[model samples]
Target: MTASVLDCISLSYQPLWGKARSLTGLALFVQPLAEPPVPGPIDARALLETIGETLPADGPPLFVVPQSKALLLDTLAAVEPPPAPGAPGPRFATRGAATPTVVVPSFLLQDDSLVATGVRLGRDRGLKLVWQGSADAPPADDIRDGFHRYWLDLPPPWAAAALKDATRKAAVGQQIGPGRLPPGHIYGGIESRVLMEYCLDRCKALALAGWPGEDVVYSLRHQAMQPSHAVVMATLKAVESDRSAETVERILSEDPLLVYRFLVYANSPALGLRNPIESVRHGMMMLGIETIRTWLGQQVPYASREPALRPVNAQLVLRARLMDRLLDAGIEEALRREVSLCGLFSGLDLLLNEPLGVLLPRLRLSRRVQDATIMRTGPYGPSLEVALALESSDPSGVQALCAAHEMEPGRVNRALLDVLSEVDPDGPTI
Candidate 1:
């Protein structure tokens, strides 16, 4: 055996977040071998013996053995089963149910490969094959230390770069996993961070490609909440190839906050509507497609902080909303939706204490909004002049955009006063 030769495989696991309290239910990460061992023919007996010997002597530890696909199947076959009825198996499971099995991946698996074998066994025996390094359940501290030590022990530079690159790649891929959004606040842990970054990248790419803002916003919502990258990629491709409103609505329905906001905007007086649009689809229909796209662009800041400078934030959202409503050529529903969304999200910078780019995704906004936040660098940046101009009591900027649009600034001013009256009868409209 050479330096590349395995002394024995050890259990290693990394969670997306949180500390592991026990080893029983957690999936184990198989620490990587320091060197690439020779590709010799698979040997089941030798591998099992090596694993058993390497199992930690003390302090509850699970053995996570990695071997060639052939050897793993052979070893599983040779392993002892039921300790006779009324006896317990080494792992826990309900009566007649298969024990849980974890399958951690360092790289993409080959089809019909080693992992596939384990998956087949899991399905047949009713075992659960969980990916260990998930965002929801972080690795235990002790386990993380063990893996870090093992990684550090490897040869310098090359080993370090490889580990870093692998983690980044894994994080990028993990943006879309096949799991449901953890219940409660939609995001706040490891998963949210990865998804936010992924959404940002997508927004950047779309902006560079000159994709429409509405399309981009819709895409982010579809991808950000999904469980896996494969799904996100598939949905993105579908939407891009065919800009379908129905698909976008289905994705938006997943988040309650988004739904409520949409409904509220759909029914607002800004829409000048006699009746409310009750359903998401009906609301979408009542609001023209282009305007809805604009709304999506503004949705990213839904979770933004309620600005400390309440008046300032209000003016920001208000100005942007007014611009959207005034400039829009769509139906009342669409214009109202766009203006309200812009108003709601425009003051995000004041609240988040960061640039719009840094704060937008935290709002879990659609891709369109992300683009407007980042790439709309021109004078017409969606929330740019409007937000700033609102602060100027003179309202010169508002006068300018209104002049450019050939609309009377008085009507717009009246609209502002109207909204302010509703917001606070005692407060003066500056």
Candidate 2:
């Protein structure tokens, strides 16, 4: 397509993809690269490194695929045994958290086709593949073909025929839910309101039809954010309210993806470190609930919501975490947890271009989490507001907001830097 044509299209196109297409159009206008899809081998290591680089400090969970050829042994060795038939899975080594991985069984098999691998990962992660393979090289068309075939094979009894028809109906503004949803869609914006509503409707529909809600939530998060964050959110939410450690352990035993990410992040300089966290369980034990919650909040990627929005989440999270630390404010750890959650999802609906009310149900978040996310008039809402204001680089506005709490902008700024340093001592200082 011509640059002008692409420009006329929504900016929702992946930035990297848009840039690639723009360059390709220019190149084709001049002289074409000998290859069509610009073929090359997928570099797993390089892709991981780039993901690690692109990751935001206070973003959503990072979904990482191992080097296509990398062994799962590194992550699997530590997995606890699955639970007995009726028992809870192994508790995340932490009190209230899992080790932070989402295991996708089929990803074990890899092939020369990038698309095939991507489909497997997406199915395993329960998300739509966003940045499939790596950015270092382009895939052969074989990859894309294989991916479609695999995806077509992954869905349950809902035949590809049925699912395709349903998707088409949804696209044309047909009755998609138990109730009418506002017109906004993912192709439009990146606010939390838009995303939550879209997901909720889909989840409700699945539940109404007696299907598992996991797949629907996964698709929403993927379409709204990226596969990594989407899967993390879906996986974590899938844990039953009364779930025990045994149940968690069982899930982890088979989920290598979650294990790898947990260990990687646990040891990553991004989490601030004097040494590498050696195991998922060990990391969970050492990180504690508050720290783990913070990490999860950061890992929830909303990058695809809007290009301009990518950094906004990071800034808000940085500010919220900093404020929590500065006042040593005698605030409950749970409140800090709320702050982190609010910061991450505050713009979810906007990013996905859906309504908050429509999507909140899919998350199955506590009334507290839901209240904070929607009303912004609740306990955690004020902090979210402050975090967002500061994200715009408006120190004065932040100061004004904190005035009631007897806090100062300078103090908030310094504390935020300190918190950022503490969270990622060895990674980027900011």
Candidate 3:
């Protein structure tokens, strides 16, 4: 059989942070799901090619592939680069022109012969080697001279906290001298445990600090204010029309703050504008009605008087974009719009301190959108579940939702990666 097993595999990337919290590398893991129905030895070349196709062309050069023995022996062994100039080697070009530095598990060094062969082949093909240590495979002194770099794998449960500690240690290590311990030395099991405990304490503190409690929600709603209902209605209406210059201008006139924010966003570095937007009419023409619609929709929920809600607002925008991308190519245009709305409104109860049953009616959303957001049972509900699953880092939940909706994990991951870039092109994707 052809290597259809490769289709079942998915890549999950974890970002490695440096001293300044900058992206130093990416750790790629092949999520070990249930075996494909037509199981045999997976075609290593095909699996690598499939993964290569899914990765962004401009991603980081350092890749930490999984340390599975099968992958080490079959996959890495088979990944050969193009032949050197006027010399004999593999004819086919792998993935792309960039030869990534592959970080394998330290256990591979246990077999000295394998290490020698793999290192020689990797060097010849321009692939540098780094060694990663895990709980099961600790670093060995024998392999110390084989690789130039070393990384420790953080256990999944404490990964976030460990990464934070590691970043802090790295930052401090940069400023200290000979007596000080470096980041590498501080990122071991004991440090991770301490960081994890600290993280738990911080989480408890945040929980008690009025984040999602009803009191906090109520306080936020009482203090927060949104744009005028008339302006909102007019803007929504303008979005449906062919030429809305007059409507848009009137709305801008009513709310100068809206005008200022719109101009700022339009002219922001993210949009890469050559000339400044001079008027609402200019913005309308340049950004188009749909872009303006989405922007306006985002502003309504996010324009809170309380500064604490800023992060919440950002999260709402992220959810909307994520849902939009996830539903791409899968639903009708109108349904896609509704799905985006559902995502935006999913947090309405928390944002407004009112039940969605009471709050959604005010927005005059469609019955299906209301059902999906409030009850979580409708055509759009499954997509929302998938989005939430991803947000919560629940892989099993995400897989179940994806399977129920006939969505491919690879496509979902690709969609998520694209949305992440769109949301924060310059920020690290973690």
In order, the Cα lDDT scores of the candidates are 0.37, 0.36, 0.52
**Residues forming the 10-long window of minimal summed lDDT in candidate 2:** 21-30
Global lDDT of model 2: 0.36
Sort by lDDT, top down from the best: 3, 1, 2
Q: Write the per-residue lDDT of candidate 1 for residues 1-430, one digit (tens) a residue.
A: 2421132222222211111111121112232222224454434444333333433222222323342454445544433332445865543222222222333332322444555555455435533333223233333442232121111111244334433433353355465332222211111111122332332232111100011222223334432321222222333343445557767654453233355466767777788666656555677778876666666655543433221122232244345444454443455654344334444455444333347666554433445444544565432354344444433313345545544545443344333333322332112111
Candidate 3, residue 52: how far the Cα is off, in Å = 3.6
Model 1: residues >4 Å from true position, as ranges?
1-313, 332-335, 362-368, 375-384, 404-411, 425-430
- Taking all chains together, the TM-score of candidate 2 against the true structure is 0.31
Which parts of model 2 have CA positions greater than 4 angstroms off? 1-224, 229-323, 326-329, 422-430
TM-score of each: 0.26, 0.31, 0.51
Best by lDDT: 3
Residues 297-317 of candidate 2: C-alpha lDDT, one tens digit per residue: 555554132322223233334
lDDT of 3 by residue, 1-430 (tens): 3435434554444433333222334445553345544555556666555445545445544353644556565655666653467875442224352334466666656666776566656655554466666533555554455454555434665565444543454355365222212233213232232342232232211111002223334554546545333345556666666545775654443332344456667766777757655445556778877888888887866553433333344445556657778775857655765776677667766755568788655443468887888998887787787777665312456566777888877667666656644433233111
Error of 2 at 163 (Å): 39
